[model samples]
Target: MLKKITLIFISLAIILTSLEAGTSKRKGTAGAEELRIPVGSRGVALGGGVVAEANGVDALFWNPAGASFVNKSAEAMFSHVSFIADLKVNYLAVIANFGGVGVFGLSLKSLDFGQIPLTTVDAPDGTGETFSPNYLTAALSYSRRMTDRIYVGANFKLISERILRESAVGFAVDIGLQYRLESGLRFGAVMKNVGGNMRFDGPDLEWGVVIPGSEPGAPVRSLRVPLQEFELPAAFELGFAYNLKVGEAHSLTLAGSFQNNNFTLDEYKGGLEYSFNNMLFLRLGYSYVNEADYIFNSPSFGVGLNIPLGGTLEASVEYTYRKVKFFNNNQFLTVRVAM
Candidate 1:
């Protein structure tokens, strides 16, 4: 136990040192911004502070280590988010637990931006054409119970983004660790979106340009503008949670987390949950950043219900609401099934 604890601290120190060294002054400059968006409704409702207690398929997007805590043999979840600026996010995840081997998970997240009229330098108003942008991420995850109290997990992700004829593809990884105590206390840490830079390239970046002072009737030279590569938004997070039993049928959980980002300000988050007989749940959460102009600083609210369909079969429905500063508020709905 002492060795395990020391190893955890050593790993944390290494990751923290690397993150500090990689910090950048340029904020909001990451390319794969979609990866930062929250997927599971439960985690979003918890203000992203549920890293320690997240479980089953819901953990695929938060802390993969928690995926090893699934009580069922298999679990699947589907979620939809009504995001700000009229955008929509859809997420799906499935996980299967093997008795002594490990747990494997697969997940996909996609963003939908409705068609928008194309515009150009010459046609500032409209170009009589419309295009839809596509952003998608697919991830494969593995988690194992390293010890009675230690859980470890990792996720390998493929990211793709396209706008018209230009497209960018990249890969990233997430590593997570969780430690649970018999006293209902949990600790978790995760590093997300660690990868190389991504650059856009396609036919749209190439065009024919004539030299200024060439010969008469000279052929036009094909010019291709080079695009700058952008780094991924990497973040390191640490969190803890305590589960308290109020009575035989009632319980409460309190969770808090601190997140440090490479390209943005650090954030602090806290969440509270009340549960009745493990069937009904109510949650309240809030997140704060040092920056005063952060858009998602408001409180979030959520509710959930779990029902047993039959022997070894269960279903859950959850919803969350978050207030946005300028744009419309964000809402999420999720359905999960386990057997």
Candidate 2:
């Protein structure tokens, strides 16, 4: 079973790689970009290099395959991100594991753009009105431990975006695989945002126009301009992680990942984490792109504390900070509970 599962994932990786080839010309062309935003403090703090090690509810946004590895029967997570450009992101996820069946998860991520001044072509200066953009993604995920060393998972996502009176709805899927070795080495691969193009439609696209050659008293015709569809920002990522024990109460983890984006430059990420007695964690990570135009070029740092609330219940708090270029730095706060 493990062999067959591995083969299937490898085939998918090959197909996705082929599809991503020669896509550089489409840079900055994909829509539904909110899908690319990172959530979960731990994963973001690791520069998104935790694909191989992510577990529990955190894996819902990083690599679903790891979700089945949670030690608890159920888990829940909440996170808030202070993104660049005054954007705010809120994320919530819950997962339940059924022995011998699988792990099922549900997650929601919403972007808060706040309020913006509404203006039309005729009122370019001030319209005295305000509108807020709404972007949300709701996902249902399933994950299973195919074998002692192999895990597989997938997520089905519903995406919605609304701007003023215009809105777009789309769907996507994410598939992931994780393999672990007894030596504390792990490998992960994921294909994310596989879906159809999205096109916006609503009353905002309709306008009244008068024919140029029409005579006097000509009636104005209503025209609804058709909008072009934009492809989703798809990506394929491969990652590796290794854990080393330094003593009875100390350990270290090293993680790295390579990401191929269909609508942007490729990225390489690396992260280091230290843990003491499985209670406290410190992490540092960095990301590199071939070009210098990427906004998040600086290092990321984070810390986490795990507390046992009682029998069979545990709680965790995590915080991360990421430096961005030419913008306010990003920060994430996450709380998690397991029982």
Candidate 3:
């Protein structure tokens, strides 16, 4: 099973890379752009090198295949992010594992941009109106172990973006495979945000307008402006992770990932995590992005604490910090409970 999974993921990686070769980065062509933002604090702090060994609700966003690693029958997580420019991101997820039936998960992520005063051609400054833009993603995921060493999973998501009376809706899917060797080395691959294009439409786009050439006396008709369709922010990712024991209760993890992004540039990331007694964790990561791709492009740090709540129950709190160029650094806090 491991061999088969390996062959499949490698083939997929090759195919995706080949197809993406020579394709210029279409920086502004993707819709539902919020999907590009990382969801899990740990993953973000790790510079998104978490395709392997992710467990519970977090796995659904990184590499669904890793969902098979969930040791709990049920798990729940809540995450909050203080993004650049005062934007806020909130994420919530729940996972249920039913042994042979597989693992099922539901997750929601949303970005909150504070209210902005309405302005129009007639009102240059403000129209005395306010509106808030909203971006959200809702997903359902399923994963199962194909064998002791192989796991596979997929996720379907509904993505929506709304600004005042204008909005766009689209759907996407994520597929992943994971394989682990007895030596504790793990591999993972995933294809994310593959879906049809979307275009904005709403009453805001249709309003009364005067015709240039019409009869002497003509009535104004609401004309709808056509908006070009845009594809989703798609990407293919490959990653590897390994854990090494330094002492009886001390361990270290090293992870790395490479990605071919459809809407931007290719990227590589590396991360390290140190654990003490399986309860306290310290993590650091770095990411390299192709030139002119983005503003936030580098080092991140994180810390986490896990506490046992009895036999099979536990709770954890994690925090991550990311440094950006010429902007305030990003901060994320996540809380998780498992049973």
Candidate 4:
């Protein structure tokens, strides 16, 4: 299983790199549209520190390779995000261990736009009501420990989006690797959203150029043009984390990650998390990245609780909050269960 997963990711990496070879290597554009795809709530909280400490289903989003470290028989997680007005994002994931073979995970992320007032040029004359645009992503993931200190994983994803009445669909993949070093330090890398382009195939497609008048008896010819396809917001993230055991009951973790955004440019995020015997966790994180208009520099806070339920049951809840310039506060709530 590990060998197959590695081979698949290797091939995918080569293919994605080839497609992006000629494009301008410029980073964030004026309106970095695809940057809005929030990576993960837990990471967003700890400023994405999970790359090193990741475990359980959260690993599917942070660093799938970490899923191999999960000791639970089964694990599940669900998260909801109040990102902005009319925009809500939600995610659910589950991971199960298969004896001594490896671990498997399934995850889904959906962005919902509440109903909006549909308007047209003919407006009051009214054509039809506006429909909210929504996007969905479903992925299957696998993680394994090829060796004692090396871990790897891969994800196959299905993506679909609908705007008003038009829709488009595509597929993508994610690959990640993590290695632990001495002194409680960890290093990791991941490539995300690598895939082919998608074309909008909804209604309203017209044939041939509509000209006022060409000739007295000239017949208009139908012209077919290739669909306009957009590039995926592909990116690479490299991170490092170190944990300091202050005492028997207290520990502090500091982590930083650099993101090489394919569509945008680059970003830096740093954070710190403190834990009390793994029972209580408090995290503070900050991110810095240039934006077209306003710099999306913000700080995040999170709190977590780990409760042991009898024999094989475990429960946890995490809440994160971040303040973005010119936007309402972003809130994320996630619940996790293990057996």
* Per-prediction TM-score to the true structure, in the order listed: 0.96, 0.96, 0.95, 0.84
How many collisions between residues are there in candidate 1?
A: 0
C-alpha-based local distance difference test score of model 3: 0.87
Q: Per-model C-alpha lDDT, please?
A: 0.90, 0.91, 0.87, 0.75
Q: Which stretches in model 1 have alpha-carbon errors above 4 Å? A: 10-14, 21-25
Error of 1 at 237 (Å): 0.5
Residue-level lDDT tens digits of model 4 in 230-257: 7677777767788899989999988888
TM-score of candidate 3 relative to the true fold: 0.95
- Which pairs clash inside model 4? 27-264, 27-265, 28-264, 28-265, 43-48, 118-130
Q: Model 4, poorest ten-residue lDDT window?
A: 27-36
Candidate 1, TM-score vs. the true structure?
0.96
lDDT of 3 by residue, 146-217 (tens): 888888999999998988878899999999988887787999889899999998888877788779998877
Model 4 scores a C-alpha lDDT of 0.75
Where does model 4 exceed 4 Å of error? 1-36, 124-128, 207-226, 290-295
Q: Would you give me the overall lDDT of model 1?
A: 0.90
Model with the higher lDDT, candidate 3 or 4: 3
